[model samples]
Target: MSQNQSRVTEFILVGFPGLHREYYGLVSFVLFLVYAITVIANATVFFLFVTNRSLHKPMYYIILNVSVCDFLFSTTTLPKIISRYWFQSGSISFIGCFVQMCFVHYLGSVNSFIFSLMAFDRYCAICHPLRYITVLKSSTVHILSVTAWSIAIIVPLILAIRAYPLPYCASNIINHCYYDHIGITLLACTDRTLYSFPAFTSAMIILLLPLSFIVFSYCAILIAVSKVADSKNCVKSLSTCSTQLIIISLYYVPRCFVYLTSHVGIQFSTDVRVVIIMLYSLGPPMVNPLIYCLRTKDIRECLVKQFCISTGHPKAQVSVVTN
Candidate 1:
């Protein structure tokens, strides 16, 4: 298998077989609901961050970026998948496959990196409140966010270019998964490590390294919150941080499993792969607004008011007893 042998024409994407069989209607309904809810939820965050002056601070600024990333990440794959399923065509062209893989990974990696930035922001805000204003300036947050996406895009682009020219004339079936380094390597005739090495390293950096930083930052935040003199302040800070922690854990766990635990050469069951894919892809966008609405008082009120008005229902006042 010469290096030149890797160059190929097109690839096939076997759309999730789990939904293709008996659960098509159910799966479609679930995805549609999730997609609608995710879009509205993330868009609300974006809108609030943009329109509200009170939300102009660094923390909500970072949250806005996270929302944007979640929206893009979900849109990269889920919509097209729904369309293909409805239209009864499971195949994606070679170019379509490559672009989808690139965008999905690019956005997913950016989301992870931005979450790290959020952790850092939370750390500074909670652990060093006095210096928070100066430490996490708007420019600094912007730089970090931009840098996160820039690196995410460049690394994937290089890897895609290097790995793409390979020949796939033997088998065109790319499976339904996106950004699968192992799957691509298994189908390739030449050395897989060249592509896998950079791809693996990038994944480790994007997934593990930022994850370590987030974990460390949260530890520091928890310690700092514990030392606060005001019990009310302590409770408030802990509540916010705990919510962030839960959301972070939810977002990171499935990703860590996919990137870290899954064997490189082995193939996973269709059901397992579909379930895992659905969980991570849908989790962030769906759960994010729920997190914000649950944890933040203002956003929750706004949502409730908006919902009450939309449905013409009585605005039920629920007391938030923060312990």
Candidate 2:
């Protein structure tokens, strides 16, 4: 490639043009608050898992890692978005775009992988309770974590590198908040099929395939739990699985909507785009810790005890994570 045909130096972002004129201040403020809360929430979850022995189990381990990924994933775009939305500068360097895409893809993949693992963990716990510890040993967990992260990083790196090989003489206006393929494709003189192929594959692996696994595994788990003669055990299992199912749906619905709309050639308004992106990126991180606190008795009890100890309440107060 000639010097002019090299990777873009900078691209102008056109984040929600319609929303930009109306309610810019309101949207920016709301996004800022969501970003801040997501960081704090995920960080707290990771910290809790690290400090609390009661939470040092396989399930919490996956949750802690998921929180870490969510924290990184949200940070990849929100800060720049806050700057652009509030300060009227929506430009990102080509290198910056690549880095943004890398981290976003990596963390998203890691989050998906962790979700799959969590499903399997629940399966083992419910179906083969006696062998849970042996099945998810420390060595196996470490290997799985490393493998997930490696694949997430490696695939994105290859795609980003390959995408820069062609010319980029088209308009440098990125029509999205971040380094999404649709925005970048508009900048390419070529067909942009190279970028699309990898992204399509990655999406299938990260979202659809894992979702299939989660749904199937949970279904099996529910069936297995129903086989127990004890009503108390059945109720307990149903409650726990229901919580997981709810969280999975919350995490997935926005993404599925975006993907389906894009595939169906449905054009989203700038305001709609902004709203959907924020919902997809921010909701999971903020909701995860709340889910754990509300769903698990031990975590809630521990928090209550800790609260009582600090506040000198003489007794623990029950608290729930409200929506």
Clashes of each: 4, 0
Per-residue alpha-carbon lDDT of candidate 2 for residues 163-241, written as tens digits (9 for 90 to 100) = 6555777577776777765566557787767678777887777788888999889989988987999999998888867
Tens-digit lDDT track of model 1 for 190-248: 66777787788877877888899999999898888878899999988887777678778
What is the lDDT, from 0 to 100, of the residue 220 in candidate 1? Answer: 92
Point out the worst 10-residue segment of candidate 2 by lDDT.
Answer: 314-323
On lDDT, the candidate that comes out on top is: 2
Segments in model 2 whose C-alpha atoms lie over 4 Å from true places: 1-8, 265-267, 317-323
Clashes counted in candidate 1 amount to: 4
